[model samples]
Target: MTVVISAIPWLVVSLVGGAAACVPLYGGNVRRFLRSSLFVKVVMWVPLFVAFVVAVSGGLLTGLVSGVLLASIGAIEWLRRDTAGRTRWYLALFVASCAVWPISTAQLAPPLWMTYCLSSVFSDVTAFFFGRYLGRHRLPDWINRDKSWEGVLGQLLGGVLGVLVLGMIFGTAPTLLAGLVIGAASAIGDLVNSVAKRIVGIEDWGSTIPGHGGVIDRFCSLNIALAAAVLLPR
Candidate 1:
């Protein structure tokens, strides 16, 4: 109840801000905007958010179990599909590091856990839009062709804003710092995941969700963000 109540204002800000930004991006074509991939992604977030709320509400053990299950699925899939032995080893290490954060963060307060998860969500959302609309300098074609510096700037902005909005729940100063750390870590996590896919010669980790490819695809940045949030001084 408390979690839902606190998230209402933040949710409204994110949705309204996202919709407003799309207006110019689509040249006022509401129909086209509604049909866009961004719109689909936004719509898909509903179920994911529900699941998140339930998982945290279930207490630490449940969150830990859920994290372990997800990590195992992602790790097995990624490792089994990749043919490159050396890179597969690196992927294993990466997956293990990613797994630790969420499992550990399960012990934290629900609001803090939610903040960690949502920071990455905000970063991902804003980066996609800003990258599409204002991106000029492209990232290396091999790692991730679509990413750009402009998108990164947008991610930083989103991360900061997300934490600020939830400032009443967590202390403002610490969360602001955590936001920056989480934002940067989120970007790195995303890039690493993209690179892993490129190496494996696959478009997505799996096809479990519509609009969002797989659990791994959707939550790639989350564990890293959780790590950042957890590491912050209480």
Candidate 2:
């Protein structure tokens, strides 16, 4: 609990920053750079390596490895003539590191944390696919078309279900609230990412997650949501 409370804000800021950075990499101009073989290699491998390190280790080691990876990616992005896909790989890598470190350390209370993580995952999964398939009514033109009221509803339902189940297992209002807030926050976070990407004229963020795109692509919403859960009143 102490660790969670202390880490929440830092985590949120980092995740948000990383997500915002991805805009340049995956959004509107992606094709201009992804066409390059080097850009493809960076996007695919750098972030994954960062995630793996963070997952296996915590503390300074995680930070150190992540920093080095981000620096390398940033330098490459800057130097490479194809500025289009340049930031995508580094942004994806940074988000991956942010997510994996906390989750790996959160194993302290495996059931509770895992429940929280799983619930978040389910909510995001449902919302993403559902939004893509069923969405027709559009958001305000200012907001990304990718996000919809339908998706938010799906997220809310999924979050509520996740909280109910996890709450039953944990038998605590704090735990239940944590799940709810995190799920909602995660959905909001996703919107935040989309908005940022749209503002910068990017698309998928990065290609780190295979079908998913980037780490921010996969976990941006969840991480922010979970961070909110940690800070909320128990």
Candidate 3:
């Protein structure tokens, strides 16, 4: 109805941009970041997601904000002395992917939002542990020294678990499939953003997001995962 109609454009844009990012990923770097900061960041975001569900019921376009919330990461490109086509591509795809989930909420109901966002969070949470505790094999140093097969496995496990739980809580049966898609997509999106960070010669996207770095640093993978959910039916 009204919601679905309004959401189509963002969905189309998200799928297109996310597809563009699906390349033979080289890998991701073992990034340096503050552990305490990460903890604070998660603590803050969890409530926001919960509030988002409540807000959706009361009619707020928080989804639109979700879609573009991380687009500001593009600003760093201006700081680069050697900007290239990569900058433009990353900026476009990043913003488009970020925009998708908001549009998706417009079409779907509150439960879908819960299922999608939680899947992304779980994927990241799992990946971090897997990468830190068990990662040994370094990808091509040029690609990223920090990523490993274990991290990938963790992402899948986490995404699936999150999606399944939310699906059950929300009473959405078919959302189980989201585990496979969102887990993988979110990881790929993270790797893509890692590449962008390397090119710009920086770390943590920015330090403005209160222990999370910047809006982009925190939500890069989430946006990509949300884009995947948008393409998925039910």
Q: Say which candidate scores most in TM-score.
A: 1
Candidate rank order under lDDT: 1, 3, 2
The models' CA-based lDDT, in order, is 0.72, 0.54, 0.63
TM-score of 2: 0.56
**Candidate 1 residue 19 C-alpha distance from true site, Å:** 3.5
State how far residue 56 of model 1 sits from its true place (Å): 1.4
Screening candidate 2 with a backbone cut-off below 3 angstroms (N, C-alpha, C), the clashing residue pairs are 26-203, 27-202, 27-203, 28-201, 28-202
The estimated TM-scores of all candidates read: 0.84, 0.56, 0.73
lDDT of 1 at 231: 73
lDDT per residue (tens digit) for residues 22-141 in model 3: 221212221322233443554465455544554455323766654444465545633342255456666667666766755767766766666677678768867876886688876655
Candidate 3, lDDT over the whole model: 0.63
Order the numbered candidates by TM-score, best leading.
Answer: 1, 3, 2
Q: Which has the better TM-score: candidate 2, or candidate 3?
A: 3
Deviating ranges (above 4 Å) for candidate 2: 1-108, 132-134, 166-176
